[model samples]
Target: EYGRDNGIRLSAVWLTHDPEYPENLPAAPLVRYGWTPRGELAVVYDRSGKQVRSFTYDDKYRGRMVAHRHTGRPEIRYRYDSDGRVTEQLNPAGLSYTYQYEKDRITIT
Candidate 1:
């Protein structure tokens, strides 16, 4: 199913556990999508409506993904350059990868 707000689309989608499951249980009990007002994916829930994962976006960067947190895990973050290219990614383990761009090649360090 979907909800539209002015021009946004695809608010939610139901998935099946098994295509050949019985008619009464063709689809999974519950799986939901939560969308931001700007049409960005915000969170996902399981059958009990518990958040499975959540996402955060950078409003200043044309909706570029800035961070994402999963249940029981530390949030991962990203940084972008002025050109909107990803410059750094920091993971839960505190390891960070930095990206450098050249005229024809990209390097990670």
Candidate 2:
């Protein structure tokens, strides 16, 4: 919906096999979506076409995303507290910065 609302066109292609794990056997039609004026997003599916994993956009412009992970939970690169303020963020180098918010001030640790 973000893409459609923001006028970003989305196109998809089907692949006969998993590009990341070519040796592991699975049925066909791995759907990959290309965001025009941006980049591509791919989804992995089981033999029944049920979504096994989906690439999630990290921002409104869809310019960045969490890297694809075949196993385990995706890492939390950005975190928000109950009030919706960002509590933590991890950079590409895997370093994490903590955020502290108060009624009138914000602090980073």
Candidate 3:
């Protein structure tokens, strides 16, 4: 992450809650409701810590998400380029969305 408000680096050392003992992580959560072991569920400020992104957790660590909370739920997926840029999104119904980059921003077209 980059800086918070007041142009300070996001590197300020802090304490985080541990479900276990002794192992510590970053405190000062970015979420409002709460956070869990998987990480915060609210909003994510990327490495730049400027633009925010919405995120949710999947039970699996890799591969595709087999099931989700939404029904009629498309099998949403991301196709990444060699550089890891998300190049496409495809749905189960065969509908697709192409992605392109504009400056530092990513948008689905």
Candidate 4:
């Protein structure tokens, strides 16, 4: 509720606790949020303060995600239409997948 009021929405959360591990082990949790004001996803960071992933939004508020990588470049991207539908996606291998939307159906190519 507080997040929504601040124009941010919680999308997902991950928590980890290893009971069998040593007590000195560090905790690693992740949280993701979406910026509601401009309809973009805010960056998610790990407990160590390193960026986990980030997102971009189109003019109409459609979102595209770019996952972080330890090395090389982030290798996933998406494009959306004005109606907030995903129109295309690019994978790590650089393969492009296109989407087609019809009044009653959606087709992926």
Task: Point to the candidate with the largest TM-score.
Answer: 1
The candidates, ranked best first by lDDT, are 1, 4, 2, 3
What tens-digit string does per-residue lDDT give for candidate 2 at 55-83?
54556535455344443555446666766
Considering TM-score, which of the candidate structures 2 and 3 is the better prediction for this target? Answer: 2
In candidate 4, position 5 carries an lDDT of 37
Candidate 3 TM-score over all chains jointly: 0.32
Per-residue lDDT of candidate 4, residues 13-63 (tens digit): 544455687465554445444353555566666556666655555453334
- Candidate 1 is scored at a TM of 0.75
Instruction: Flag clash pairs in model 3.
Output: none
Best by lDDT: 1
- Score candidate 4 by lDDT: 0.58
Residue lDDT tens for model 3, 1-109: 3224344323232345567766665455442222334443433333334434333444544322222223235546666665556687777777778888878888887
Each prediction's whole-model lDDT (CA): 0.79, 0.54, 0.47, 0.58
Candidate 1: tens digits of C-alpha lDDT, residues 25-85: 5244366778887778899888677889999998866579999999999899999988899
In model 3, the runs with Cα more than 4 Å from the true position are 1-36, 40-69, 102-109
TM-score for each predicted model, relative to the true structure = 0.75, 0.33, 0.32, 0.51
lDDT of 1: 0.79
Model 2: how far is 6 from its true place, Å? 8.1
Candidate 4: residue 68 lDDT (0-100): 24
